[model samples]
Target: MQRATVERVRVAWTRSTLDDRRAAGRALIRELTAELVPGADLRIEQRCPGCGGPHGRPMLPHAPVLASVAYAGPWAVVAVGSDRDVAALGIDAEQERAAPDLAALFPLTSPPDLRGWTAIEAALKADGRGLLLSPDQVRLSPDGRATVPDGGEFRILPVATAPGLIVTLALRHPDPGPRPTRRP
Candidate 1:
């Protein structure tokens, strides 16, 4: 797969057991690195920073570091960055079957409701901002579009492997063009 452009967003999915899930995630990370940074050897592993839980983030033994990881349930996803750009990416995966309390975890009171909630969480993480805004402050449209609380552009893409998992990527940068003038 080609490297995703700053304006483009991509999501990849694979089915596997818990162990296989982690392996698949690592493989994806390698592939991404190859696509993003050609001729560079990359290796990814899960290590605990004395936190008991496995840390899914990747680390490059050599210099020029860039990568991030997010794993939920039996799925793991990684994003690799470029030299001039910081990698702002997020991934989420969930079981295809309905869980007993999934609704409670992610309440879907109405249609188009669930994607927004998921997008907000993903966007915040992607921008390195977490829980900065309340759930009600952000809104998601019926067509998978999301409006950031502070007028930022956010892109949301649903993961393919799992029905309940949704991944969102948000990019915020200074406006370089001339500002639009409004007439009353």
Candidate 2:
């Protein structure tokens, strides 16, 4: 990790113990990026959806690798794949029995809605649009595929992870094959 990243983690810890998870998510992204591109200068950019600040999705702007990192209760996940094969990638994990009650909590209205919500989140992250778009704008095909309102196909694949963790990986269609799933 870079000095800035390490210092950010320390500062987060000072704020609250729960913020440790965010730090872990950052560290995991660094480790995974290193593994994917060995010996190269790894520079990560956190592109903010709202203000373009240093607090959003972690992106390797220079490396020929595409990645997405997400964290939830008891889980922190990073998805790494060749930029050639994957133009965009997103991964999400949440407790099976957990659901946020916020109106913008991924648009969960029922049990079946969970998968759609997860799929939307993954797609949004992959599109680099984050939550800037309303969750209600996401449309899921009856065949279980998800599409952004403006129209672009995303394949949502169910990932088998630890028990009680509902994992989903989203990538723009025309993908070649599976990449890797790193957890911490």
Candidate 3:
């Protein structure tokens, strides 16, 4: 079988509401799963990191592939990867604005450049803690690499996006496979 790579969204998700976008995103993921990894069972799971609620990062729990979804206005993006290759992965999209203010939002770390900020955000998302994880704890060097504290190292890259949109992709290498779950 040919090696699979992360699949990015081609068409924009035109849903007006979050609920609609989420459902549509999952459907797209299901289709992408069939095309990307043939014969693999795809089950999308979303459990909040802070709480055990069902509104968290969309992922394939216990499955060999990792997935993440992000939205910006009317656009929704999904990213999928094989757990054999990606320990963790994240993708994010933000609409570009003039002189955006993020320092007030990201107190621990605020990158001067918009692309850098998106890169940092992608790494944080890959770390799985998202905003809960302080940006200061993330280590991003001159290279397009970031090491998350107590998490996997990630490679952040810019993804081609539509006009007025800034999209970033983060992929954590050397996935150690699924952790053993207690029978509790």
Which is the leading candidate under lDDT?
A: 3
Question: After superposition, which runs of candidate 1 have C-alpha atoms over 4 Å from their true positions?
Answer: 1-10, 41-87, 99-114, 129-153, 159-184
Worst 10 residues of 1 by lDDT: 1-10
For model 3, residues 1-184, the per-residue Cα lDDT tens digits are 1112333322223344665777767876666676657876778888998988987788766456777777776667777766666677787777786435777766765554777777777888888889788766777778888888888688887776567777788886774669999996
Q: What's model 2's TM-score?
A: 0.75
TM-score list, all predictions: 0.55, 0.75, 0.77
lDDT of each: 0.52, 0.64, 0.70
Better of 1 and 3 by lDDT: 3
Winning candidate number (TM-score): 3
In terms of lDDT, which candidate is stronger, 2 or 3? Answer: 3
User: How many pairs of residues collide in each model?
Assistant: 0, 0, 0
lDDT of 2 by residue, 74-153 (tens): 56666766666666677776776886554645445532456666777888887778788776667777775778876476
Model 2: residues with Cα > 4 Å off, grouped in runs: 1-17, 102-112, 173-184
**TM-score: which is higher, 2 or 3?**
3
What's the lDDT for residue 42 in model 1?
Answer: 76
Superposed on all Cα atoms, model 3 deviates from the true structure by an RMSD in Å of 7.5
Ten residues in sequence with the least summed lDDT for candidate 3: 1-10
